[model samples]
Target: MAEIKVEKKKPIWPWIIAGLIVLVILYFLFANGDDDEMIDETEQEQVIDTTSIEEENTANWDNNRNDTVGGVDGYLSYIGDESRMGIDHEYTNNAIIYLMNAVQAKANELNVNIDADIEEIRQKAEKITQDPMATNHADKIKDAGSDLTNVIENLQEEQFPDLSQDVQEVKSAVQDIDGSVLTLEQKDKVNKFFDEAGDVLNKMS
Candidate 1:
């Protein structure tokens, strides 16, 4: 019979040390990894927040400029309906609103970005009505601008003479505005409109 030898049990210290080492490695692997992930998550959130703010600012700027252009064009049409053809208030108001919106849409289509100040234009438009003594003058000035714009709208290069006198009158009145409500950009538009209208009117004449 082979003699069975009793094997001595190794000290528990080695096993305990091996287990502690495994735990420490796991803590660094998972716990420290999670901390790194948290930092990445924080960075991603900050980038998203900043993007949202920039988008909001751009939207606000677009809306403001759109409103400003619309208001100015509306005022122009309103006085035109009243002065040129004796259009009633309700029709004039509604038509002016539509025309103004149309102009804004066209500007957008052409990518003619303008940074018009809506509040400032509104204030000036309101002031046009406030001076009782000069109300008619203000109204006439607006009418002249609108008439010129209309003439340009209808111009066909072949018809310019019929509106020659009106074109001259519009130019004179446009120049007389104390400071002018239209922006420099708008003034440029006005000038182009006048040139086109004059060419048409001269041909017609």
Candidate 2:
């Protein structure tokens, strides 16, 4: 009888178990990788949003600063309109009063300190406006002219070089108004000041 050699069959379970272990490990690694990617994406988005907010805040601040700086130009236009309207009619006193008010308001806005004499002159102009037929109307106008001159003189040329010249012209025109009437020449002179001041302010930026 020939002895039959029985071949030993290797168990397949070990191979199957090793393959399953590999699959589990792969699954866990892939899952952790996805989580890491999600975290990175979220962090990136947060950074982008934070940067946008910072940029928006900076733009808003610049806009506000520009508006404040440009306020004088708008006020000057308003004064010009009032002056033209008043000069064309019998409300010269009222025009002067409104003009001085504009000046005072602008001074306050710019944090400029008005001299006491200018304030007194402004008050007198206001009173004259309340009574157009006041006997001291001419005197009040002259005093306001003086005040304007003083204001122009006190202003630092280095700080307001562009404005000083126009303001000086305005003072000259105001001084030329000898009576309650606004002459056409004086009106033209005042308008010239407006034109020059507007040009200067527009060129600021």
Candidate 3:
């Protein structure tokens, strides 16, 4: 017998099956990693930023605080809100001083001298300013306000033709504001100053 060489063919099906199994395992691992990354991203997106909310709240508070004070104009401070008038002595004193100055200015404008009349009023204002929670603060303001209003009203009509009408209106304004509310500020204490005389002073040209 001649030498015979026999060749055995190896089946490739086992290798193919092994390759398919590896591919399936890799797919599952990668798919799980991608899902985990997506979950982390979703968690980050769901987080809320409170910094902007806090800033907005602070801004609103500042606005409310600013609204409480109308502001100081020249020699006058708005004296806070009307609700704090009677109890707020410092502001009340400031308002009285404003009225006193207004009266003197008006007299000067009309070429009249009221230095003597205003001296007493000035003293009262000084007292209110120095005293803490003065028991008679309201009374002092009322007296001073009335005195100044009368002085302004008594301007000689012959010399000041507007005394009977315009000045009279000013007097009425003062009387009306005595125990009432004024703009953004003033009340039982500084009502005459803000509601009455302050308005007039603002209108004075």
Better of 1 and 3 by TM-score: 3
The per-prediction CA RMSD against the true structure, in angstroms, equals: 15.0, 17.0, 14.6
Q: Could you give candidate 1's per-residue lDDT for residues 1-205 as a string of tens digits?
A: 9999999997999999999999999999999899999999999999999998767645533444445354334444443433332222222223323333443444344454322522233223333323334424334335534543443333322234456566555455455443334222143433343333334333332
Against the true structure, what is each candidate's TM-score? 0.32, 0.42, 0.47
Best by TM-score: 3
lDDT score, candidate 2: 0.54
**lDDT of prediction 3:** 0.57
Better of 1 and 2 by lDDT: 2
lDDT of 3 at 139: 57
Candidate 1: residue 75 Cα off by (Å): 18
Each model's number of backbone clashes?
Answer: 11, 0, 0
Model 1 regions more than 4 Å off:
1-7, 65-205
- Residue-level lDDT of model 2, residues 8-98, one tens digit each, is 9999999999999999999999999999999999999999999997686455333332133335454455555634435223344434443
Error of 2 at 50 (Å): 60
Candidate 3: list runs displaced more than 4 Å. 1-88, 156-160, 163-189, 202-204
Error of 2 at 166 (Å): 3.2
Against the true structure, whose lDDT is highest?
3
**Which residue window of length 10 is worst by lDDT in model 3?**
63-72
lDDT of 2 at 187: 58
Q: Any runs in candidate 2 off by more than 4 Å, and if so which?
A: 1-77, 80-94, 115-118, 134-136, 156-158, 162-164, 180-205
